[model samples]
Target: MRTEKEYVQWLMSVPRVGYLRCRKLLEQFGSAEAVWEAPAQELLQVPSVTRNVAEEILVSRQSYSFQEQADFLKRTGIRVLHKKDPEYPLFLLQIHDPPHILYVKGEFTLLDDKAIGVVGTRTPTNYGVLVTKNLCTELASAGVTIVSGLARGIDAIAHEAALQAGGTTIAVLAGGVENIYPPQNSSLARRICKQGLLISEFPPLASAHPGMFPVRNRIISGLSRAILVVEAARKSGSLITADQALEQCRDVFAVPGPITSPLSQGTNDLIREGAKIITGVADIWEEYPDWQANYSHKMKDEAFQLNPEERQLLETIGYGGVHLDHLIRVSQLSQGEVYRLLLEMELKGLVKQLPGQMYMRSSV
Candidate 1:
């Protein structure tokens, strides 16, 4: 017996039943099961369901295999999330055309609700690389989930930085999650599955093509509170993401780059056109006072049980890791005192010690 969800999955699998068409069918019939039971004439009554399309749906339904779909999803460790599913991102629903179905790998937590899309040219200048790393690392360390397409350059850098910061990230793929594009990022995609998430609107194992990139760009922006363009040419896909962000009523942020560089033109144009100019993570935070306040409150809550000295040390350690020598100098505490406090804090699980005697707040 086909479950209601399997019926919806079957409906999605029908030829020519794109996101909009699928949505229309659901709206008209109230459920995929109802759509399946409806006669060809009834299916045709739904907007955009032409005679051919209705007939195709009927033909496809007879051939579709729910068990095969279930086995594929299980084999790939992918979860099929419909728009009506509680796990579907609430922000994505606000977009003009949210994908009716998302194939997701890994987990989505409440932390993902605070996300920023980081996009840029696939071939970036040294300056672009630096800016992307700094901004993404800071944003991730601040508990903002970094969202980006799993392309080379800025997107890969963003995901790497977030993982390095011990923070969450999400990769929105142009292809299916299992069919990682560019091939070079296969290792990175695997890493993301362990620490973050990989999501796509396409069926699992579907290979990406040129046409799917622009369509994939919308979800990158849709899933984020804002979109940050690090570097882009006068004509680039990054601009498409920024445009989608604006259309979705999400904030668009751009890093100002040298006017002499072609890579900077798109971002400069965005800044000139009233997109927020992001000099640093603080600039991004300024637009979301509630996020800043909430982060501050979280820090305070975590420190509520700590003594003054411990709290001071934790504050000094900050979000990013700091060297023991730097902590001692900045805290103006004796080497022996700093060492003793760090050991105590580590034991308390409030701080984590990294390679090179670096310390960072553990909660982030």
Candidate 2:
């Protein structure tokens, strides 16, 4: 017997049955199986279900096999979460145009609560990179799951930082969960699937195009409790995510950068327009005191688990931040080895690299 999820998946495949129409049908018929078995005349009775949509639904059901779709999901380790499913993202359900089904890879349960989205320009400045790494690492260390678009630059940095901190993250894609866009982030995507999740609205193997990102942006913001804009130009896609977040009534935080920098334009504007100014994780912690408390012990435990070399290195840095040369000198390591180990530690989320090649122990 086909599951209700399979039936919803089949209904989603029908032509002209986009999210709104599908929702209307579901409300009318009570279940996807009932909707699928309903006659064309009855389908037409549902609000906004025109003759064309009703006829298309009837015709499409005869051609598309639910078994085939289920088989594909099983083969690829993909799961379809219907809107009514208990495991479906609660934040997403409150959005205006929530997708009827989410094609997901990896841990869907990670999205149940406590996520923050990090978004910015594809070509971020060094300042953006540093800020994204520090904030994401701190938040992840504090038990907050980072959410992002899985794009290059800031998004990639956010996901990597979260993973390095041994925290959960979610990559919301514009394409199919099976198809990683940009091709360059394939390895990162695989790594994310192991510790976090990869989610999409498109079905398996569906190619992503320019038009899909706006819709994808909504899901990115929808899945999170807040959105952080690290760096964005006046017309960046990160701004779109921020706008979507505001519409969803989620808090938006912007990192203030040098006013002279081109990359800071959007975030600066956001600050001017009353978005919260974020200097560190404390700004976020003020809003999520409970989350901060929950992860404090975990962060300290992870910190204590570091090896002798790492612990020594971390001790040398202290809380005030140390220059790279000082860090190497104090740790008694070669310059090359210091850089290599620092990078490794940065990925492990034990350290944060600041501007001017300085390093600091993570504040978590």
Candidate 3:
């Protein structure tokens, strides 16, 4: 039985025998040991295990040593999460094609239900960078886990901002967790390993290839409750992530930018096609109200006794709400006055509180 488990790991390490086929092979043969013991002709009987694949399996098993693979994993401090492992991400199992094995290189826990994926282009405008950082920071501060592809632009910004906010983040890589593509972000990758997790379906030493990212993008979306595209060109890989998110039945949020900006075209197109426009975190909470229960607002008895200045403050908050500092800036009020007024408004039920000292008009 122990050897069979090791054989299962070995089978996963074989190239060209991807997740779906591996799953089918296991179901048909009952175990990796059974599959290995079967003659090539019998292996061919399994659906989708073509003659070539069966032959490849038989030939490869001759040289594949489970002990060597296990030793390397131990030496590198990498851990494997087999499909049947109790600790395998539950959300991933719900996706159409979950990887049979995940090579994780960091502290990893099954994510909280409030994870949101943030992704975008490799190059972004100044506005895109600023908004991605600010939005991710606020979301992280609110106890939401940020998930991203760990690519160069918005994805890297999201991960950094989440860490900066002293919150957990997960980086799902296009290559191996150990490879750390783009190389420049290797330092950031090391930081993520300490504070969050670095996960990949690829083997520990696999370098990223052009075709790998689209496959990887699905995991980014599958692991989250929603996906936010901070910015993307019309033909960006971020759009591919959005499509995968929709296919996974996850909500998609796109930040609006100037209409004429090339970076905004993809997001604007998403909005026109019915994706939610993310002006603030409140917009996200409105879609998943259950996720917002911990941050729900309550009315205080003294709230009804608001002064004229409080009403002006409440109106300035708008529907999606503004951050406390942002409110003070636009309202031209002192920080103390805005904080006092916001507390009063919250008590009255005229406004609601959000994570990170943000407020919005009360729909009730």
* Model 3 deviation from native, Cα RMSD in Å: 7.5
Ranking by TM-score: 3, 2, 1
The C-alpha lDDT values of all candidates are: 0.83, 0.85, 0.80
| Top TM-score model | 3
Global Cα lDDT for candidate 3: 0.80
Q: Which is better, 1 or 2, measured by lDDT?
A: 2
lDDT of each residue in 286-324, candidate 1, tens digit only: 788676653443543443357778788998898799999
Model 2, 66-138: lDDT tens digits are 7788788899899888888888888899998888789988988897869999999999987688778877887
Better of 2 and 3 by lDDT: 2
Clashing residue pairs found in predicted model 1:
none
Where in model 1 is the C-alpha error above 4 Å? 27-30, 38-59, 110-112, 293-364
- Could you list the CA RMSD of all candidates, in the order they appear? 9.5, 5.9, 7.5
Off by over 4 Å in 2: 1-4, 14-59, 294-364
Say which prediction, candidate 2 or candidate 3, comes out ahead on TM-score: 3
Better of 1 and 3 by lDDT: 1
Query: Candidate 1 at residue 294, lDDT?
Result: 38
Clashes of 1: 0
